[model samples]
Target: MPLLFLNEKSWGTACDPARAERAMADFVDAVRAAAAADGPGTALVSEVDVKALEIAEGYPVNKWIGVSPRHRVLWQRLRGLQGRSPVRSVFPTENAADHLEYRHDGEVVLGLGAAHFMDGIAVSLPVARQWQADSVALERGELVEDDDGTLDMRHDTVVVRHLSAEPHLDGHLEWIRKTRSEGVTTGPRIWDSRADLYPHLTFLPRVEGQLGSLNPHWVLSVRRALERLEEAVAAWDPATMAEPEWRTKVSPEGETRKRVCRFTDLDGETRTFDLHARFTPGAGRIHFRLVPEEHTIRLAHIGGKIRPDL
Candidate 1:
């Protein structure tokens, strides 16, 4: 959960722990119902949600996608969160929305800036790429938007990352209840996949916008991207998911601006990944296909792959 966890502190008194828990439960129940519903609100976004849920047991579908953020509105309905800080804010001398971030037993383990939890997991992102606002800083006046202005990150700025996967609600609630429970306090623009579809820098929204408008076509393209991502995940051996780290290396080759990376799997199998950038969406931003798949780091990047090896 990077952002979109409304900080309960922002809600002042309305941010009750028990109430928040109740709200979380309610939100999840609503989502499950909504997932089953076929009318209205079931647009492009719903398509993504329902499809992922449908495939929950089929593949790597139930790892929690982007549902956490959607349920934020649900909690607001249950408990009218307070927004106006009794004190002055860094940017808005006045606070606006009243939302509970998230908590477990009592303490604020993690406050969802704009997220809701169902089952034991939370969603991280939307592979479909709607250019929505993802987050905004709580203490700091940092605005983290998506490629498009569809989301209002100004308010969805509370969240946590790197949480240990909790098998059940009891564990998750404990994590949220403890202020110091596997905590990763952060500011805006941070990228820690403890939760989310991918590792997105807080500035991803801004960066994506510079590329171009995010329309259905772009979203559909993102669907393609997800397909690629899923393919990678599927092809990835579970051993790679656990221990035996895998690595990829990319390098530029002459005029081709080539990139070469290799996947070093747990089985000691190395799959050479090489790509030549033939296009870029914005200026020098390279946007091209890959020999194996459209996922490459850079002409010469030894760090994380330009795209996840999967």
Candidate 2:
């Protein structure tokens, strides 16, 4: 039998007590209905321990039991567990193999443990694993990225970008969805590669504007690029700073333009770091002082779809 309830630690809007009590009332109604149909035959009714709550989150189920009409009336009149006072009690432990449906932000995200959801945002996951996995930890300033693309650096010191707002790193999917068919890659070109790339994070061009998320890996990669870029910019000489050609004359009509690299560092400092000098045609090579950390730092070269300076 399935149980309809909230996690012990799950709270919303700073866990308003009055609001939580009302929600618990509805939850009890839902629970009793589910329990009536699943009674005795199913173990799900007793599987959840609402008392196992974190005190810090404000909504302690043990204390809030009297708020729910169903639990309140039952406890007031002495129900099954009413005689049993609030104390450490033993309950049958669930099998490790038992599958549980855990959801957050209203969407059924795969994984284990209880979590909090609100305002279309999933906040925390209260997971206590028996087995340990390899872990790594370091200071916030210790982490760095290579240079290649634009990025938004938040307060996520040791961030798991893949598990968070991923689309922020994968560029604006909305823009792509709205303008999905604009073939900027190829039709007639004198270049050997395409400009339309997959490795991009879509951000509003303005300082204070709307934003979205993307594939997490894409964001991590962009952060790596930023690391290299920071190094590249630091190593730049003042004399060679103005040499980067932001424009190139391809023809009398069609000129080859370049992209500007932008970034917001962890300190909330925003900077436009120049990468490379010139894509001077017939210089025998695409010789620019661009961030030479690695090609993996590129947004235009995503999915191997775009190649530059051929």
Candidate 3:
């Protein structure tokens, strides 16, 4: 005999008292029909317990049952498992199985638990097992890439990118998406390698200028590049800060085009800090002075790259 386990939660909350009673009656009729169709020799098992009813009372009854007569009949027959202790009913043996389960979603409508035997196309345990396996694989980021080579970042990928305790990480990602969507092409790019540092920096629309005002579009690009620099600082890795692609170098004098602007450290010794720059197309240059510490990099100055002599 096959066992049908009704989800007590679904049964108790989905229908009102009157509807529940009617659903139960319809369920009995359906079981009887199923048994009759299977012939006289087959036996079916229907079991329900009191615990399910207790839990079902706390849930809202599924009102969709009343809207469709077919749904009401089917749901009642499938999930209507309310009764006293060890409620058992018998119908026909053709519905018998080694295992039984119901699906709230996806293909395999009803699953039967049992090994292969001398019977015609009986539902078996592996059907349900395979469904569960496929679901797990999908959840684990085993996504098939479309022809365009795009795939959603999985939960694990998001976790890895979430490096800071800052709350506006999603906002940064949204800004990047928006910038790309607008087709604004200005960059000596900064986020290529140090994306992990974006959350720690503030992206101002424009920085103070000494020469002439910076272009708004160019400022936006500079802001993004500086954000990448700030991210590298927050990561506190020298290799990341010193990467050749980041354009880290000594500030240069305009007349001589030579490095200058040396700083004196706390030890009374003069030390030169590397300045980072990103050349904006037709918009001159933007420069940054990095003030390094044990754990952070402070932005000493940010503005248009003016001549050191000036």
Q: Per-residue lDDT tens digits of candidate 3, residues 65-139?
A: 454687567555534432222212321133322122222233222212111111111111111223111011111
Candidate 3 residues lying further than 4 Å off, grouped into runs, are 1-212, 238-274, 300-303
Report residue 242 deviation for candidate 2 (angstroms). 64
lDDT, model 1? 0.27
RMSD of 2: 19.1
Best by lDDT: 3
* Tens digits of per-residue lDDT for model 2, 7-88: 3333323545665555444434433433343333212211244355432256566776655666567433323322111111
Candidate scoring better on lDDT of 1 and 3: 3
Looking at model 2, which ten-residue stretch has the lowest summed lDDT? 114-123
Give the winner by lDDT: 2 or 3: 3
Q: How high is the CA lDDT of each candidate model?
A: 0.27, 0.27, 0.33
Q: Write the per-residue lDDT of candidate 1 for residues 1-310, one digit (tens) a residue.
A: 1111223232222333444334344434433332223222221112122222322122222222234654455434323322222111211112321222333333443233223321112322221121112322223122222222232323223333211112222333443333223322221111232124332111112223432333211222232233243344345444334311122111233333223344343235454434322111111111222322322221111111243332
**Which TM-score value belongs to model 3?**
0.27
Error of 1 at 150 (Å): 18
Deviation in Å, model 1, residue 20 alpha carbon: 16
